[model samples]
Target: MSAFDCIDTFITGGTAVIELNRPRQLNALNRKMVSEVVEAMESFDRNEEVQVIVLTGKGHSFSAGADIDEMAEDDPIRLELLNQFADWDRLSLIKKPIIGAVKGFVFGGGFELALCCDLLIAASGTEFSFPEVSLGVMPGAGGTQRLTKLAGRTKALQWLWTGERIPAEDALTHGVINQIVSPELLMEETLKFAAKIAKQPPLSLRLIKDSVNKAVDYPLYEGMQYERKNFYLLFASQDQKEGMNAFVEKRKPEYKGR
Candidate 1:
């Protein structure tokens, strides 16, 4: 049984789906929701059956942002103790891939949550924003850092400062989202993509994610070194030999995730 009241989780075909369930509040992220997300992610990471995770909302809006009502009452100390944003860091540390399936409103903390995913697939009519500036607060999560890394400083600064809602097309153009599809096709397309990745060798997927993530934090040469190490290490795995031999035999490789 799930301890979460604000979210729903299930696994299908090696892909786990975590849906924000508070439709009444547009799934606004409160402390409880954040905590539940962290706990669910940790559980999924330990579950060998799950190869990928997809995050979405049950209703029209993916999320409206953080719970303003809760934020208004909480003091700095309380907020610090909650460690809401740190949950995102924990999610990122998971070896398996995470895909955000966004639709409708994705604002403020909601935007930060989507950014935490390895890839994002947005509905055509989805709206994304950083509305914290209007709330007289700034994004406490990795919003600033991750947005800047993805879309560059100028665009990130412009969006954060203005608190404007960016449409799916603009968000994709800005490199915030990987793909955009009709609302009805959002889940289908996202799951299809996740399934493709899930079919790959688990160890290779983990190494690929690790190496690419290093590019953001390490210098060019250091990133290359990390990539090189992972590349060499793959040679020792059974999947690598199977992959090569299958190519030679003109057959599909059966990866056991070794």
Candidate 2:
């Protein structure tokens, strides 16, 4: 259990909880925090017992964004840290699903962090925005691309260009978030969702996620081809047969990751 000042990482049953511990700073992302986050993610990725990841921050706010005070000194180290933190390869490639439990302020890097997750469940009172434009910078993470893909190019550009805060309801309606629960219930709801996913066949989940993510980067015909191939491949697995048999028998399916 390696612990860092900025993050608290723990495994509970099938889920890995990554908590941002900088409440006084509203869980702002700094170089140390970014390094800790990557470390925690890597450890969770290697742990077979961990099937899902739930990322959230402490206190009323999720995260206010990057630490502006630290960014005051603009140097190569700062630029490199920014780039490393923004890179999707750090977390998005994990086979297990990652869920973001967002509440309060989710601005700039905080917003980008949620965008990195496979699913985002926000509190009804959560505030979301990409204020990098106002700061004379842009979303360094996959935000620009992910937001556009998730909410459409025009909408994404509108939000980014304006640097305005969006409420949870609008975020959900725009596909920026999956669900909106009460602030107090945000963690519980996210856990419920994670547990539900953890109960499914792990192999199927990983394959489906890969297929969709990869297909999205291709042309329509190519994308459908990948989907068809993935569908047929899964059908050939023992888990697929067991799933159907279990349904017929009215019993829970026991998946062996086959």
Worst 10 residues of 1 by lDDT: 83-92
- Candidate 2, residues 17-129: lDDT per residue as tens digits? 99999999899988788778877887887787888889999998889998888776688776776676544467777777889999999998888888878899998889999
What TM-score does model 1 achieve against the real structure? Answer: 0.96
- My TM-score estimates for the predictions, one after another, are 0.96, 0.91
lDDT of 1 by residue, 140-241 (tens): 889999999999999999999999999999999999999999899998999999999999998899899999999999999999999999999999999999
Q: What is the lDDT of residue 235 in candidate 1?
A: 95
What candidate 2 gets wrong by more than 4 Å, as runs, is 75-87
Off by over 4 Å in 1: 1-3
